[model samples]
Target: MFRTFVSGLILLLPLIITLAVVAWLGQFIIDYVGPSSIVGHALTTIGFSFSASQIVAYVIGLIVFLAVVYLLGLAVESRLRSHLSQFLDSTMRRIPVIGNLYDLIQRFVALMDKNDVEGLKSMSPVWCFFGGLDGAATLALLPTPEPIMVGDKAYHAVLVPSAPLPVGGCLIYVPAEWVQQADVGVDKLVSIYVSMGVTSPLKIPPLPGPGPRKGNLTAT
Candidate 1:
């Protein structure tokens, strides 16, 4: 009975959680722009009375945001995007609670857009030690005109994210000689990490050995 209940929960939990999140987000937006809010007053003054059906307005706002993003992506040089991104980043940084979150998100976005495996090829790994134990190591590149004490070290960096969620992790200085290039790609690495040992490309079972010879099998 316990097993059956657990199995049912496993099947239903994702659907339940998804609906709950959707409901919460919808209510949050309604509260943010409802009749008593500043946006509500402005819209009302403009002869547009807000209603519960204005959820469609929220969807339209999302569509407009996506459309603007698409248009920005189509720009030839990305100069416009850079300027807009900088402006947004600056504004986000001014918001107290959201500033730190935005900065972390920005860093990840910049890394994904700008960094490549080849760029990581010449980098090395920096080992972090704690309580006489090796905690973690990250591949990274360093900047040039290297510090005199660290004069010979290469100039480049790569952040090595922790398991489960690769979004947050330590930043370390990696030398050019330390990082070992792998045949597996980043997408595969992400899958391996997210699945938390349940999935692995390397776990393919070996083919069974050839059957015993006919003469040897005859005795059996």
Candidate 2:
């Protein structure tokens, strides 16, 4: 019975949280945009009670907000809008304190964007080993296979992003031989990190044994 209850809670937790957020948003809109607004006044004049009019106004505001977002999304797809976006971003980056905040927000937004996440995942994923010979492995996105030359030495650039919150992380430069490209998808790696290892794979399939053929070790 305890196990069953736990399973049930796990199944319903996401739905419950989503409903809670929606309810909170509805109440917030009602309090700010519903009461004494034009829509509420119009509804009240049309025979709705004052309280009922406020509720109706809240719904209207939500609908308008969604419609605006849809329209904005359509606008963003245009070439002119794309350039305008770049210009806006550049302008924002010039601000002092706001620049850092904007950069963090931009990274967070890019990480959350489905297309961007998918694209990063589609590129090769790797387990980066840091701290030289004795090192800890970290999941990272392998953006390039070519080693960066610093003086006469070469180093691999690995993107190690934080999990539970994918907004912040570091780009580490490590010895090329220490980085092991993982045979895993971006989604799997993300899930593991976001869940803080709660959703780690039961078994990581064994990497291939020594085999013939294949030239340089290239990215997928």
Candidate 3:
């Protein structure tokens, strides 16, 4: 019986959550705009009181909600977006630890925007092989296009972003040969990490065996 109940609950959870959300939307509208509030009283003047003004009010509320969201979307595409983003950046950067966090998030958000990854010109997705050419590979981002010369050996700085967050991680310096070009975009890479690898990337391309391919050692 317990097993049956658990299985049943699992099957019904999605529907239950959907209905709960819809009911909450209805109640919120009734409380603020449509039926119980002044807007509800105004709606009554238009004979909107079906089912004691609840169902009709909820419909109106849903329409209003969609309109507000559409307007916000339009605003995001306008000049106001740049000003608002700059204001947010300056304001958020004043809050110490949170400011640092906001900067990280802001950079990632820019990466996700198809039209605005200019801020990440120095970064690119890569597969970092550990130990040697045939070693374990990791998904990472090159912090800079050029390799740093560390005592005659060239080392690349790669940032290994944390999974499910991708906002913070550790940076490591490795040989140029350890890094390979990953045929993935910033947004797709972020999505894969945020989903904890449940959303896998495309098939890995053929890599050189054992050591660096003579002409392919540069980080793209």
Summarize candidate 2's per-residue lDDT along 62-174 as a digit string, tens digits.
56667877887887776666686778889999999999788656654554556665345334677665664357777787666777777876677777778655545777887
Residue 39's lDDT within candidate 2 is 53
Q: State the lDDT of candidate 1 residue by residue for 74-177, as single tens digits.
A: 76256575587668879999999899888666645443443444323322222222221233333222212122224754422345666656655665544433
Q: In model 1, what are the clashing residue pairs, if there are any? A: 124-174, 124-175, 140-157, 140-158, 141-156, 141-157, 142-155, 142-156, 143-155
The alpha-carbon deviation from the true structure for residue 103 of candidate 1, after best TM-score superposition, in angstroms, is: 6.4
Better of 1 and 3 by lDDT: 3
For residue 205, model 2's alpha carbon misses the true position, in angstroms, by: 2.1
- Write down the lDDT that model 1 would get: 0.48
Positional deviation of residue 214's Cα in model 1 after best superposition, in angstroms: 65
> What is the TM-score of candidate 3?
0.53
Q: Which candidate has the highest lDDT of all?
A: 3
In order, candidate lDDTs are 0.48, 0.66, 0.73
| Whole-structure CA lDDT of model 3 | 0.73
Model 3: per-residue Cα lDDT over 149-186, one tens digit each:
78978778788988767876788997887887777777
TM-score of model 2 vs. true structure: 0.51
Off by over 4 Å in 3: 1-77, 80-106, 208-220
